[model samples]
Target: MPPALTSGWSRVLQGERVLGEADSILKFVPYSDCKQGCSGMLYVTNFKLAFLTADRSSYDNTGKRNRSKILGDDDIPLTNIDSIYTVSLSGKRKKMTVDSKMPTTETLEVHCKDMRIVKYGFKFAPKDQNKKFVNTLIHHAFAKKDTLLFAYEYGRSNELKDRELICDCPMFDTIIDWEDELQRCKANKTWRVADVNMSFDMSQSLPRYFVVPTALMNNDIQKAASHFSDRRIPIWCYTHINGNSLLRMSAQDSDTDQPREVSRMLDAVKVASNQRNKPKIVKVEEKCPSCQEVQESFVKLRKICMSDTMQEFSNQDAVWNTSLENTRWLLLVSRCLAACNEVAEEVTGGKRTVVIQERTGWDLSCLVSSVSQVLLDPHYRTLAGFQGLVQKEWVRMGHPFQRYLSLVTVSEADTEQVPIFLLFLDCIWQLLIQYPAAFEFTETYLTTIWDSAYIGLFDTFLFNNDHQRYHFSRNEGKNIKQFKLPSVWKWDFQLGSEDFSFFKNPLYLITHDEELVSSLNELQVLSIQGMFCRSSRNNSFTTSLEQNRNHSQDARPERIDPLKKDLLVPNCSSLSIRLWTQCYLRWQSPAQILSGGTPTQYLQQCVMVEEIAQLHHKLKTLQLRESLFVEFRSKNDLIVSHQPNKSKISELLNSTALSSSFPFSPGPALKEKQFSFTPICSYIRNSSLDYDKYVDDDWTGTL
Candidate 1:
């Protein structure tokens, strides 16, 4: 029966050899809330844990023959796993830990970093097969030593030898990339690149090369390092054209008094930023919400978003506002935005340099610094610039990725695993919604990055710092000539150009610096209202554009000058914060709409815009050809009956197909398909659109 459950080794990466494989494994249905189980083949590789159903015919009907199913939605990256458990027949779950004894249970459950839970039953397997498989999975997935990570093994492999190495944006791995970024921001005027930590002897967490105040000496940096946690010294993040700079550093060591060297370093940074005033230090622990608060709020919010049954969702929907408010997620988001705005105001309006500090300087420190730059700098709003910003602030600066987004099982008491990166992305999404054209990237880009963090394919989000990545590769993986790890910025390997096109904002427009600074006063007012009021006037920049488009047949988004400075700062009011449905609710059937909801509408608009652009290009080419033909005809006495018609071309520009198919209305034939398992690491789209027909990519699945 069921073709004897074929081996799932074909679902793994080229270099990822299977360590263990078991047939007749039953996967508990995720969509059914773990009520039913289906027989499948379970495979554990160095990279991931994959489960392929015995009956794959229904899914294979998609007709993708050549595409490599290296990693499927049913697979979970070993590094993305959060916790593991042994499930008893009596419905009792015993949490698995590094030191805990392995149970001879027939069923097991895995919890992931992305708030997903998957269960599997090991019934009908050979004697001791379950124990052998469990031991292997735990040893590989929860590698105690950094050198044991699959990154070292995969990095040393020849899988990528023949693939073209191309990246759309800078990986920021080299010194030259940092230099270029400093030059682009004009921070070089006051800051200079420091390489005191070249061998990671000074600070293991901080990058080898980073920018610091020109006035600060190497010895001063050394002395200052002792005062802060993780030795993450005050370093340049971004610079304002007004000579005000943004800096980040870890909080002072507990139970210690402020030292003289720390004072000297702060003075140097202040003088470098502005000769007149001292730098405004924003203590994240004091000003913003705590990591514990964020973690608790997200737990409640996720429970609401991932409701198991239709009745459960309906009940939650009846008092959705109250339930959401109880979670304090929006409240936390509002507080975070308010804190960022204060820093923005100090840097821009107050004309003072700002230094953001938090415990260990990785969590809240990274969040506020990045969000402030988004408010003050237009460059960071662009896709490439934002990638560089994350590289500089989060990855290079060391955000404890392994600790926060852990590979191994986490204990109930562990609070280190916080969603700081996701929170930062959420803040960026709010800004994107308030000012759509201001960003070169879409919300999809942010969501994609969130998914990429847990994928484990890229080493970008693998280690806690550069020190670990460097030493681990050098000590364990000596096969590769260069110990270079793959960066997520090289996205061409993961997705096609057409899929990549979705990340680019079709309505993107660059605004003048004067226009960016012009709305400061208005922003100050909105910032105050956002903190106190439940509801504020809907001053969305896109509102007028939408209304104008509704009135006229061919009305483009108006480029309103000054952008209403108030719009530059997001409305942090609870009512203003919309749920990121494309991310959190994408898996829930009850939460999903028939035509794929707002995200699909947005994607459809992006498609329409690209089509219109292509048509315009074709029309221009035709006109150029016609002009050349006429010139040749005049000289050679050649004549043709067919002539390019300008009027007809104009008529073609007004085609009905170019109209916005927004709020994505579907036909009667487009019915919702019930999925047996929850899809992960896949972009969900409107099933009715038949998007795969053109793209033919399996990763981009239908809803």
Candidate 2:
């Protein structure tokens, strides 16, 4: 390779071997954004597809070099590529699929899982080099073999040892982790941790150790597990304070076989819990939105999100409301939320054990089970608890991440490609919006997790099951280098300590309140009544909210103490289910504001909240001291007296909130010490101030 092909800016990671390189590759920007193309050198490595410009400049939408040098805007992990299409630069520029014949093309369009569209033109390159580049990309990028993935190679390397330390998430990777979780939830009395799947002989999908009802013997478990698909037995996911527990399992493999053994398993679960009522078997396939339906809705939504031109976006915008409805994404959200609420009610109020049953017990099962826990158990609402919940419910339960995420090309049909996890995140976002103070984590945390899913380095979301992960790491011979795969829970690897601080919700308080339950009942009374169905007459997302509200007005439940009640259900009505614009539309330059967007607003709020907390602490200290005199003319005077110094606020924000990565950065720091304190003081004064004009001059900008 010549010096021209060698990259000065982009460096390959340890164990990341470059297979092919092509120079004079023209990296094309969207015509709506920029007309000119930049010449670059493209390299296809085992780990990633890296593109380095000759000038070594990778700019953001703001025309600033804001991206990191190692994995800049043009560099995409091979695992992130969703699909690839080819276009001719010579003639009509018709896009065609990359088939076995290796079609001659001048431009290659790469669509990524992260919603990034990167186009590279080969018009100036030699035909042979172009063909080689295309071949290398297709062969390695879409390789079905698990060993070919970077996780194994990188795990075997020395670099990962240092990188692994930054992750702070409790991986829930050991049997002890599950035991600890069960004890935390007070579930150890009814459930016992078993290593029935120790060698994966019982089930390939299930983790080695999991909790099962203590009443059942190993023989009974083995007999019962044989009946269900992938041996996804009714395992304990969560247990409420009321003693009713949440369980998840797959439907029986043969419908005609009369699932007598499975019934016995359920009986054992009920017997162990000593509940008078029978367990509620929620057929998730029947109760919630189907994976196929979720996939269809996501595809339509993605097409709308990836609009290439202003004209195309406008065309979609004309019927944007209808388009969103047609996608049925919100409808699916409503259904999932409704299902969670139903399960939560059963487990908490009715004291009935709820068993979530699906075909494979991973996709919808994980979604419903996880969401219900977040709603019913206040522990899961905390940041650490939420991570553990995901680890146990989703990762340990074995949601087919490789297939659902489209990490690698499975088949031509793209059969299992669905955003089930994304849908779960969106549903959580809706809850976070409705009850902002309830969750310990911010929306930025959820979005960051979604973004990290495609990074291809984490072992957390790489495999379909513990079996696959085990096999991938297991080296039979001494000659083979053992692969080290770290958990995605170690978030420090993806974000710095300063950036990670943004994940903590400033609004969250340590004390429980009655408002949560009161709001839940209020929202439930106003919620739409029906589950989402695909009939033409029944498909309108918002049609039932008004009718339901009127009918349920007289049936509103009396508010109770939140300490006694505890659970907080969301208003999952169609109108309440919102599009997560911060996650989906963050990339569109037209959608972004002049200053920082919601993240900046959040930063300002965070700073003010911190100041208020300090003030409260001071007041408590003053009370303890029995101060002789205190100055207070009016509420306004009191607030004004304690208003945070502008310089202090600026310095505080710059050091913390403003240091986050793109899409989350709070923009530039406040330069002027004499800046207006109106926005910061608005919350204290209860002012209905319009800060839009002050925040951004271009307030009329839109996508």
TM-score winner = 2
Off by over 4 Å in 2: 1-11, 31-34, 56-70, 91-105, 126-128, 159-169, 253-260, 476-481, 509-564, 613-703
Off by over 4 Å in 1: 1-11, 33-38, 55-62, 65-69, 90-94, 98-108, 121-139, 159-166, 253-260, 309-320, 408-416, 476-482, 509-567, 618-625, 629-703
- Top candidate (lDDT): 2
- The worst-scoring run of ten residues by lDDT in candidate 2 lies at 633-642
Per-candidate RMSD vs. true structure?
10.3, 10.0
TM-score per candidate: 0.77, 0.79
lDDT of 2 by residue, 10-108 (tens): 445667777898888887655344345678788888878887777634322222332232355457888888777777655434433345556677778
Q: In model 1, which range of ten residues has the least summed lDDT? A: 633-642
Pairs with steric clashes in candidate 1: 519-565
